[model samples]
Target: MTATAAPPTSAPVGALSSRRLLSAIFALLGVVMAVWGSRMPAVQAAAHLGPGQLAVVLLAAAAGMVAGLQMGGRLAHRYGPARLLAGPTIIFGLSLALLGMCRTLTSLCLVAVVFGIGHGLLDVGANSAAVNLERACRRRIMSSLHCAYSLGALAGAGLAALTAWAPYHVLFATVGILTAMAAAAGLPLIQSAAHLDTPAQPDPTQHDDTPQLQPRTVWLLGFLAAACLLGEGAAADWSAVHLHTLHASEATAALAYAAYSAAMVAGRLFGDRLNARFGPTAVARAGAALAATGLGAGLLIGSATAALFGWMALGLGLSTAVPSLISAAGRGGPRAVNAVAATGYLGLLLGPAAIGALASLTTLPAALALPVLLAAVVALSAHRALDSK
Candidate 1:
């Protein structure tokens, strides 16, 4: 029998450059999120608003994100990922800087809406480009790219603490300028490094879902992504509240989210190796189960330490789920990836609000059960939902 020839080795330049660009984009996005998130207390004080009013303003931003996601997808489909990437990067930085400059509640709300629009567009563009890059590389690198996001988030959050004494607008504007510069520099490197071919010379891996592009498959992927992100949104919004409700000190309660963010970073850093070995289906199923179990335990124990541990577990459990789902969605092209990303963003937009609504009817701890249930649903369906066969 003739010996099987080895598959030709892929070039490293485009793949390497794409990975760098994706990492920078993810990190910058994380920085923008942390810069704004870390200043929420300051914003509330500046605007002189209560929790309910703040929620309303935040909802405006979420709505903008949803609209942006829809439009960004269509735009990416029509214009290509490169333009979407370059344009949105600058807009995202500018909008984020504008957030700190808002003096009135109305101004804050409107700026938030615009920021959300930029954020949503940037997210879709980056993830869509990532999918294309992964196809070019023929490897599992999404987890590592997400790890960059986690690292940037951690840095931003930490920096917020150091700059807590600085003027809010000044702090935000400084970060925004840095982000804009990075975007200008990093995006061109990505273009130079990318191995894009014309439609006539499409990569085989890139064409896997082109023929099918089934609406049902896309919807199922979106549902799975939403389930994962809902848990993430809840953890981000309510972990501290849950700790405070359980009677932890103010300082201790604040550490709850830090634990989650840290665990997510660690999980993602190692997730690429895991995904490569076990495949996305296994990684997702196991992760969802862990998230459900961890969050449930935290709620059940009702202790500060347990809460921290739970958040950590929850972060680890959810970290790989999104990357796996997005990678799968990417095969279907930009529109498909955007649809999945949009659905996931909807979960982020609505999950916290749903928890708050339920908190009014029941209790905060009880409301958290919603995410746990969603995670369990993901665990049960992940294999089928992510199946490429």
Candidate 2:
């Protein structure tokens, strides 16, 4: 029942397969996001949601996400993290399909909550599993697994674009059914790996003297997660619009996010190796500093090209930040990770409104400085947060 109990020759292979399975789960979640996001307009129209009503539906989902995170954490303690992954993920996929079927605001909102819950639970489950497996393997893999998410998002977006003319219901159904079916294969492997990789007995000589993270340090970790993730949300929501204001062509404006996404994926692909070499605190600190500096120069320069490069820099700089925090918090267990993830998600929810509010009061470029400032705070605080682990 433990990896060490297996033939010595098979341990590495088992670890590799487990990591890949977990990575697939991450990618599938990304696909769910891209499909749901890209099809939102259709959902709004299909459900006949009025102006600002869509926000209500989204808010419902957000609430469910927070709830799911809490539930996932508690369940992980009872059922084990690997066993906890598939149920929520399958539910998430199914709810997504159901989302396209609802024709009224009331019905859509209900399904949205379910969709969000599934999203949140699967996120925690997979991540907690990653935390456990990472320890057993004695390596840093959260970055590579997170990159799988980015790649899946890009692929999902591309497919959504190509299938733009299809009925949203058909699209959702296909994706949902496919995901539910695939889980039969991929998720079981992840659970089995967890079972195999976990040791039945501890080495008597090794004593884990590291204390559970202090509550204050937990809040600091949450703050860092929020600050950096807010920047990511800002880029997703505002990058194209920012480019448009600078007189970039529509096509060019679209490429602004493309550049950012590409850079983020690239950075994550290399992030684990970098972390192994430089340490999380150092790599994350340097990355946050780079984001702040890059965005500041971009806005100050006031050109389309400058803005695109700036966004790219910001994306790369913040790529490893949240993953590092999650891995750190996981040291305290799933509850700690739940708090960090839930708070970080709140930042994503608040980011657009916060940016828009600031933009209304000041110039967009000036408002954008908020993330720059927060990024700087992350750079300043990375050591404090990571030191807890």
Best by lDDT: 2
Off by over 4 Å in 1: 1-8, 50-52, 196-211
As a whole number from 0 to 100, the lDDT of residue 245 in candidate 2 is 99
lDDT of 2 by residue, 1-389 (tens): 11223332333447888877888899999998998988889888887887689999999999889889889877775677786677887898889889878998888889989998998899888887887777666678889989999999888888888899999899999998788778866655765674322423344454432326787888899988999888988998899999999999999999987788889999999999999999999999999999999988999999999999999999999999888999898766677777888888878889878998999999899889989999999999999999874
lDDT of 2 at 77: 58
* Top candidate (TM-score): 2
Assess candidate 1 and give its TM-score to the true structure: 0.92
For model 2, the superposed segments whose C-alpha errors exceed 4 Å read: 1-13, 195-211
For model 1, give the 10-residue run with minimal summed lDDT.
Answer: 194-203
What C-alpha lDDT do the candidate models reach, one value each?
0.81, 0.84
Q: What is the lDDT of candidate 2?
A: 0.84
